[model samples]
Target chain A: MSAAATLIAAALGIAAASVLALVSFPARSVLVVAVNALLGLPPVVIGLVFYLLLSHSGPLGWLDLLFSPAAMVAAQAALAAPIICALVHRSLERSWAEFGPPLRILGASRLRALPVLLGMNRRAIATAILAGFGRCLSEVGAVLMVGGNIAGHTRSLTTSVVLQTSMGNLETALLLGLVLVGVSVAVSAGGIALGGARL
Target chain B: MRKLSLSLAVLLALGGAAQAESIVLASTTSVDNSGLLAKILPVFTKATGIEVKVIAQGTGQALATAAHGDADLVLVHDPDAEAKFIAEGHGILKREIAWNDFLFVGPKSDPAGIAGTHDAVAALAAISSKHAAFVTRGDTSGTDAAEKRLWKKAGINPAGADWYRDIGGGMGAALNAAAAMNAMVFTDRGTWLSFQNKRDLVALVEGDASFINRYDVIQLNPVLHPNVKIEPARKLAEWLAGPDGQREIGAVAQGGEQLFHPDADKVYVPGT
Candidate 1:
């Protein structure tokens, strides 16, 4: 359940970033920089804001999503958005600069050239999305705060690792930590493969 | 964007509806780690068919969560925090459910040589004087509060001492840190009874009148959160403070040592 939610969050982040990059706004450079800065946003801050927003006394509490898988998804998405946005946007901007004028000289419109640039950089875009996936997989603080770490319900690998380590179950905690590291390494390997893929 | 958000909202609502029969209980990690809830909650669920979704945090966090109306009920051991919560109109019908005691556990070598002492303050003073390593739960928990009280009583400022370390974690974590460092730690008897990784540490100071730990249950005020599952939450609270629940609590013993004594029917006076 946690893995699926993480994937969904990464996908949303990639989609939003791609759309933003395709649009030519006057403040595009500032927006890109802002997104890059947001990449460094701490996970606990995201968790705190979400906890307040989702708490029953908060404004959005009417949605009743506190300590649920949906809240976990929200946290992961918030944490992933900056990474995906900054990486994808940078790649898209660079590719557009390289491919734009040539396509224009060929009498192609900007709208027609957009998909060409995206397709040309699909591998890099995939790499960026997978990098976001790796971040989501390894995150603990945000998810633990929003999901409440309820066993058999909201508990994820990283949260369980924290709980076990704190409870003197070093063996179990180390095993979970190794599993997380293995999964993230696998994801990074896939990203490397995609980056090396022939477009 | 609107379409995506709308679909996500619908999905979350559906998931929430499926859990309509469950109650969200904000509680402390000490209670959860004691293994007492593991024994009692199952029976309550089996008999009542109500699912309990427990969010085990520190006593302070549990009370704060309940105050925010995110929880249907709360169980914690900090009497001052509970009183403040009820006074703020976030809770109602506070019931004293059970009782335990706190003690100092340290290395078997007894570096401070205060083992088997009935004076908690004297033990802490000895530990400070000997410059022995001491792990503190520093997380604003009930046990942490008691530890601070003992330090105040001892009239020593060990905060910056090289021998004192605050781990800012739960009871189990502090115990684990102490085990790893061969340090001394203050913990409630319930978590100590169920803790499996004793390693080289043994209970040092206990049987002190000032070391009593009392637990209480409170339902989130229905007026504050009208949408809370008041009926089931109140039912669970009543069950926890009733004869059956007290019996279950008393029955939970680790290695033939009782972790908590049933005290639901007894009148609890603060600071007694």
Candidate 2:
């Protein structure tokens, strides 16, 4: 359940970042800094805020999402979205500067310029997705707070590793930890492959 | 200059001599959060002169830490897992120290209407049939394992659909999530009473035969790692099962409510 939720969150984050990258913004440095700063926000803090918003006492508690995968996804998305968006933003900005004069001289419209910019920075976008996946897969604090780790239901590889490790089940914990590492490595390899394909 | 150098050397030697050997104890969050160690450990130090460091984690993690010899001793609940540890030769000389029961807590309105059911399986099934919100501690802790067993006994698959929610976390966090959602959740009574976010939720079901939760203390076998402080670890475990430690365990408090009952005298045979 956690794996599925994390995958959904990664997809949402990448899509949101792609849109943010496409939209024109002034003061590129400020936008990049704002997004980058959000990348460092603690997962537990995000979990806490979500708990407040979705708990019975909170405004949106009616949604009944306090311990659900939805809550986990929301928390992960909050953690990953900004980082993904910032990476894509930086990539597009650099690529745009490189391609700007030539496209303008060729009489290309802003609409035409977007695809060209995206094509140039596709590697950066893939890297951004990989970064988001890494954040989602390995996170313990937020998932522990929001998802509630209910075995067979909400347990993720990382949480399983933590729980098993705590319970003295080193064999199972090590197995889970290795799997988590494998997932991360696979995501990184995919990112590299995607970047290489673009080149 | 020579006299100053000698004085500095003496100070460094004194500092080195004062350094204590640290023994890591992996224990439950309930014991850690209740501030019990602060009250208890100083006395142990005074008597034994060995500084003990407590690393608080859930039962699962505590057991795993001991298995790896990352910790010298483990204090945790969940008998089946503890037995597995003993059988696997990761731990030795397990002793019962304290116990508490699991409680079903939900919103005051009782959306699932399981208020008085003594049968945990029946209560879970009713909650599912009603399609009311239910919070699960999906984090694979002992409480989570117990919850899964209840659902299995009830013959209901708790995944899928909007009614069942998995909050992958510890008991306290899971309880808070249940309280927040006004969803029914299975939690240890100790954590339920100590939890700070018990606003709209109250204990709806408890005192069933199936709700007993026991905590145990055991030392990691020094045979696994010769460097492990097995002597002190065994002493701590023995102390926990002895009268003094049992007394200490029975005396833990939250708002004047006793959080656990010391069960050192009880023999725990699995599947009983």
Candidate 3:
């Protein structure tokens, strides 16, 4: 369940960054600043706000998002998008600063610069996605708030580990912990591989 | 230098003495939020002079803490898990101390029209069939466990239902979610009374056999770990179930409302 959520978050992050990068003025710079500030937003607070929005009395209560995987995905996406965008933005900004003069010297048009910018920051974008995935995979508070930890449905690896540990199932919790570590490692490796292929 | 060293040694000795034979007690937030511990523990301290540090988590987590020996004693409400803990030999000398009822509260709109239905299962079914939003304490707390039992009794699986929302959080948080969502929830009467932001929710279905929630005090079995502080733990448990303990439990208040009715006689029946 967590794996699927992380995949969704990664896709969301990329899509969000792409939109922000294409539409905004001084796009990379704006994204970098916004993402850096958003990185500090507490996960618990995010969960609480979403909890209200999705609850029955809240305006969006009709959506019935509370305690669903969709709610968890929304939380993970909110948490991951900024960091992913920021990293990609920074990478693009730095690449622009370094390559702008050279590209101009080579008679490159402004139109040609966009693809060059993306190519140079391919690894940075992958790193951003990986970071977002890591944050979503391990988060307890947001998931707990939004997902409701239903055993077969909303429960994720982190929440399960906490639950198992609390239930005095140390061995199960430890095994789950190991699985979390493996997932993290696999995600990082995948990110690097994908970034390498892109570059 | 010798005089300074002597004073330092004296300070260290005094600090250790001040620390005394302290034991950790993990209990339900209902007890903590109700201010029962403050009234009761002083009596135990006066009698045994053993200091106790209370850590409040949900009943599920409280039992889990005792299972890991993270706490010397546990006071929680989930009967099935409590029985399982004792059966697993993680706890010993368990006894009921108090009980309260669970209330099904929801928006005054009463979308499900569950009011007066004394059957909790039927009420839940009505709420589900009507697709009225229901907030569940998905945190696996005792309330969550009871909610699950009710859902099962209703012959409906709420897991993937669009209206059954699981906010995997403590009772208070879950109640808050229910209130904000204008959704129905099953909560301990104690937490519901103390909850400040109930919005427009009111108690819809209550006073049923299934609504009875009992709390127990148990000392972790010293047999499991020889290092367990059995004597102090026993002292605390005994004190809690005794006269002074009952008084303390009865006296706990929130907004001038008594939070729990301590059943020292253990004669408090569930359904009646």
Q: Taking chain A by itself, what TM-score does each prediction score?
A: 0.88, 0.83, 0.82
TM-score of chain B of each: 0.92, 0.87, 0.87
Q: What DockQ, on C-alphas, does every prediction get?
A: 0.46, 0.02, 0.02
Pairs clashing in candidate 1? none
Best by lDDT: 1
Better of 1 and 3 by lDDT: 1
For residues A46-128, what per-residue lDDT tens digits would candidate 3 score against the true structure? Answer: 89888777654466755545555677777776787677766776666666668877987899865577677777677777677
Put the candidates in TM-score order, highest first.
1, 2, 3
Q: Candidate 1 chain B: worst 10 consecutive residues by lDDT? A: B263-272
For model 2, what is the alpha-carbon lDDT of residue A106?
A: 100
In CAPRI terms, model 3 is classed as: incorrect
Model 1's chain B yields a TM-score of 0.92
The residue pairs in collision within model 3 are A55-B181, A56-B181, A57-B181, A57-B182, A148-B168
Q: Is candidate 2 or candidate 3 better by lDDT?
A: 3
lDDT: worst 10-residue window of model 3 chain B: B10-19
Per-residue alpha-carbon lDDT of model 2 for B52-150, expressed as tens digits? 667556788778656755567888877777889888888767777888888899999998888977888888878988999998877656777778888
